[model samples]
Target: MPVLHALKRIGVLFLATAAILCTPGTPGAPAAADEPGWTAEPATGRAATARPYFYLEGTPGTVLEDRLALANTTDQERTVTLRGADAYNTAGGAFAVRPATESTGAGSWISFGAAGTVKVPPHTRAVVPFTATVPPASPPGDHPAAVVATEGGREVGVRVHLRVSGPTLAALTVEDVAVRGKGAGTVVAYTLVNRGNVALAPELALRAEGRFGEVPGRGARALPVELLPGQRVELTEPWPGAPVFDKVDLALTVTAPGGARATAAASAWFVPWAIAARTGAGLLALGAVALAALFLVRTRRARREPPPDGAPVPERAGQTAPEHELTGTSR
Candidate 1:
C-alpha cells in the first residue's frame, strides 16, 4: 500500500511540472515591439489639455513656469539631455532652432532645474518642470524659442512660442521687385522685410499691366516663409505666363495678419533684342544709303547750275576773255 501511494505522488508531480512548462509568459510583461520608440512634448495639464507646443506669455522681468514630458516605450532605459535653444527662420523661411551652445535669446532665459537631464525607464514617462525668466530690458513681441532633447546622436525639439506682453505690430514691406529671364523661363524675384516687432506670415499677390492690357498675374497666395521681426528674405516665383514681347508694369502687394499691407512696383521690357537688333541694323543701312543719295544729287545740281553773280569764271585752255570788256555792250 505504501508503494502504491508513492507512485500516485510521482504522477501528480509530473503533471504539475508539465503545466508550469506550458505556460506562455507572466502577466504585465512587455510584448515584442509593442512600444517601439520615444517622444518629447509638452506635458499635459491637470485639466487634461493636450498642447502641441508650449506657449508662454509674460511682461518684462517676470517668470513663467511650464513642464516638458518625455516618454520612453522601449524595453531599456533612455537617457536624454535637455537644453534651451533660440528659434529663428532659415534663409528659405523654415522655422529652426539654434544649437544649445549658441542660445542667447529667450532660450537663455529658460531653466531646467539643477541637472538638465532625465532618465526615463522602459514603458514609463517623466515630467520635468522648467522656468523662463524674462530679462528686465527684454524687448516686446515674440521671442521664439525651443526645448531640445538629445539621446545618442538623435535630437528632438519642442517649440516654445514665448511672447513678451506689450504692444505688438505685424508690419512688412516688399522690396526689390524684379523680373528675370524671358518668355517661358521668366521669374519674379522680390524681398520681404518685417518692419514691425512681431513675426509675420505674409501673403503675396502679383499683378501686371502690359502695354496692350492686363497680363498674367498671380492670385493671392501664402508665402512659404515666416518673416521674423527685423528679418528679410529674398524669394523668387516662376512666371511661366510672362509676355514674350511687351513692356509690363509689375506690382507686388504683400499683406500680413495685423492690418499690415504694402505695395511695390517695377517695370520690365521683354523685347526680343535679337530681332530688334537685326531690324535696327537694316534701318540704319537704309538711312545711310538715303543720305548718300541726297549728297550726290546736291553735287550734281551745283555743277549744272550757273555760278552766282560776281563769281570768277575759269579760263579755257587756249582762249582768254578781256578783263575790260563790259557786259551787254559791243566793244
Candidate 2:
C-alpha cells in the first residue's frame, strides 16, 4: 500500500512536470472531433452531465463538495496541471476564466484533494475531489469561478457557480452624464456603476428638452452588458438630429433587475454663432435705412414751407430800403 501511494504521487508529479516542459501550441484552437487530445469535464453527479458546472446554493459558513473529471483520448500517456481561477464575462459577453497567476473569491475558497497535477493513461480518465467553503463574511449573491486543467500552455475549464444565500440587492447608479458634439450629430455619454451584490442587465432611456419644447426623445434601449457587482462601465448613445440652438436639458434613466432605478441630468447650450451674426447684421442695415429716410423728409418739409413773417426787410448793397436810408442819411 505504501508503494502504491508513492506511485500515485509520482504520477501527479509527472503531470505537473509535463505542463511546464511542453511547448505551447496555437492559442484558442478547438480540437477536431476525431483528433486525439484531452478534455476536462464535471464529474458525474447531480447536474454535472447536463449542466457541466458546479452550481451550489449555501449560506455563509457552509461547505459544499464537488468533483472534476480529466480524460485523455490519445494512445499515449497524458499529464496536466490542475488549478482554479475566478470567472468573469469578457467584453464580448463570453464566459472567461482568469489567469493561473490570480485567484480570489470563490477560486480562493475552493480546494482539491488531488495534488497540483494528475496523470491519465491512454483512453482513461481521472476524478479529483474538491470542496468550497463559504466564509462567514462573504456577501450574498452569485460568485462565478472555474476549475481548469493546463497542459502544453493550453487550458480547459469547467465552471463553478457558488451562491451565498441571503438578501439579493440590485442597486445601481448613473453618473457623469453629459452631451458631446453639436448640431444633428450628437451623443450622450455616462457611467453605469453597480453598487449592490447582484448582476444587472440595464435598459436606458434618454430624453432632451430645449427652450421651445421637448425635442425628439430616444426610446428605451436594452444595453448588451452583463454588469457584475462593484463594476462600472462608461457608455454612450447616439442623439441624432439634436437641436442646434437652445439651452438643452438632458436626462438619462436606467433600470435593471430587482426594480433598480437611477436617473441623471445635465444641461448644455447650443448656439450657431455664424447664423446669429448674419441676423444681427441684417437688423442693423434696416435701422440705418429707416433713419436716413426720416432725415431727408424733415429737410424737404422745411424747404417747402414758408418762413415766419420777418420783423425787418433785407437791403441790397447798392439799393437800400427807404427806412434804412432815412435813418442813416447815406446810401
Candidate 3:
C-alpha cells in the first residue's frame, strides 16, 4: 500500500483499538461532559477570549481530564464565585443533558479545587482543574460542560467540550516535542516515539496543535526517522508565525518509520517562552547599558576641558594695562 494509505489504515486501527479499550461505560470512559466552558467571552460582560485556551479528552468509560484558566482585564477589584456546571450533548446540535450541580463536583469524575467562592484579584488569573467519565450507554458524539462565575451579582463563565469519536484500536503516543521562540514567532522540534508492540510504519502530518501558533514545514525537516517499540528520533518543525501562548499542544498524524502504519495525534505542550522572555530582557538590558554609558560620557566631557567651541579668551600674561593715550584729535 502507498505510505499515506497505510498510515490512514493504521490510524483507523488505532482509533478502533482505543474505542475497544474504552467501552461506553468503562470507569475511565470519557465523561458525559468532556470539556466545560466557553472558549472566549463566556458572557457579554467581556468579549470572547479564553486567556489560556483549553481542551480535554479521554477513553470511553475512562477518566476525563481538564485544565481551565481565567484572566483579569477589568479595571476594578472583583470577587469571582463559581456555580452552575451544566453538561450537554452536541452530537446532533446543542442539547443540555446534565446540570452543573449534579455529581458532587464529585469523585475523580469531577475534580475541583474549592467549590465555594474563590477570590480573583485584579489583573490576575486562576485555573480550575477537573475530570469525568461517561456512562456505559451514553450515545457517542460531542459532550460539553461549563463552570460559571458570579461577581457583583453579575456572572461570567466558560465552557468545555469533548468529542467521543468512539475508541482507539492501538495506543497512539507522541514524543520529543520542543519549541523555540523567534520574535513574535517560534521554532518547534520533536521526534515520534512509537511504543506500541507492533512492527509498524506510519505517515506523519501536523496542523494547528498549540495554544495559538502556525506550523510551516517548508524549512521544516522531517528526518529519515523510523520507530520501533521504544525507539525515537528528533525532527524539527518550523513555526513561522507568532503564537499566542507560552506553551500549547498541536494535532497531527504520523506513520511508523517504514510508513506502513499511520496514527492520528493530538498535540502535547510546546513551550518557547522562557527563552523568548530572556532574550527580550537581555536586549532591553543592553539598551539600558548603552544609554547609561552615553550619559556618563557626556557628563565627563562636560566637566573636563571645554571643546573648541568653548575656547578660553587669550590674554597677555605679563603685560601691564596700556596707559591710555590722552591725545584729543579734532574730528
Candidate 4:
C-alpha cells in the first residue's frame, strides 16, 4: 500500500513537470517543428499598441531600451532563459538567428541586466526590459538581431530590427551565372551577394539572344528574397522555353530598391547531341554505300572498255604478256 501511494505521488509530479515544460503550440511560440506552448514578442505597453517586432534606431555610443513580452499559455509555471542572438538570412534566404554562443554584432550589444531569466505562472505574461548599447566604433547601418527565450530545450526568438543612425548604402552583385540542362528543363543558376550596408529586395530580369536575334525570355519580376547586408544567396530561375538547337547567350539583370543593380551573363549550347550523333552516323553510312556503288560501276566500265587504240595493255596478275608478243595488238 505504501509503494502504491509513492507511485501515485510520482505520477502527479511527472504530470506537473510536463505541464511546466514549454512545448510547441504556445501562443507566442514560433511555428517551428517543436511546439512550445508560449510566445515571445515585442512588448506592447497597451493592448492597442501591439508590435510585431522590436525596432530600435540610435546613433553610435547610445543606449536604446525596449521591452520583450513572454506569454505562457500552459496551466503551470514556465521558466525560461533569455539571450540575444545575431539575425541573418540562411543560404535559402529564410530569417534565422545564430546560437547565443555565436552572437556577435548587435546581438552582443544587448543585455537584459538582472532579468536574464524569468518564471511566469500559468496563463501569465512577463515583460522584460533590455538595452542595446552601441559602441562608439560601431558602424552605421542596420544590425539585425533577435531576443531568444529557451525553456526545457525549446526556444523562441523575437526579431529586433535595429539600425545605427548614419549613411546607408544599397548595393548587390549577381555572380556565378550558369545555364543548366536544355529545352523545357533549362534553368539559370546564379548567386546574389549584398555588397552594401542595407537589406535589399531584388528583382530579376532574364534575356536571351541567339545568332539570329533576341529570343523569348522572362520579363522583369521581383524575386522572393530579402538579401541581408554582406550576405549572399544562391538561386535558380526556371527557363521552361529554352531553345533546343541554338547557341544562346543568357544575361541576368538583378535590381533592388535604393539604386541596387547588378548583371551577370552565361552562354549555353542547347543541342540535342544524341539526335545529332545519330543523324551524323546515318549520313556517314549513306556516303560510304554511295561511294562503294560508284567504285563498282567505274571498275566494270574500265574492264569493258577496249585498250585505248593500240596502247599497251597492262599485264594480268597471274600471266605475263606472252613474252611481249604484240601485247596490245592481240590482247
- Model 2 C-alpha lDDT versus the unseen true structure: 0.69
Q: CA lDDT, every prediction?
A: 0.74, 0.69, 0.42, 0.76
Q: Assess candidate 3 and give its lDDT.
A: 0.42
Model 2: residue 178 alpha-carbon error in angstroms: 2.2
The list of candidate 1 runs beyond 4 A from truth reads 1-36, 272-331
| Candidate number that wins on TM-score, 1 or 2 | 1
lDDT of 4 by residue, 236-295 (tens): 899997887888889999988788899988888888899999999999999999999999
Top-TM-score structure, candidate number: 4
C-alpha lDDT of residue 100 in model 2: 56
**Residue range with the least summed lDDT across 10 consecutive positions in model 4:** 1-10
Ordered by TM-score, highest first, the candidates read 4, 1, 2, 3
Candidate 2: stretches off by over 4 Å: 1-49, 69-78, 87-102, 120-128, 156-158, 182-185, 244-246, 270-331
Candidate with more favorable, higher TM-score: 2 or 4:
4
Quality of model 1 by C-alpha lDDT? 0.74
Root-mean-square deviation (CA) per prediction: 18.7, 10.6, 22.2, 12.6
User: Model 1: per-residue lDDT, tens digit, 117-232?
Assistant: 88999999899988889999998998877777777665667767687879998788888889999888899999888889877777888899999776988999887666777777
Each prediction's total of clashing residue pairs, residues at least 3 apart in sequence or on different chains, is: 0, 0, 53, 9
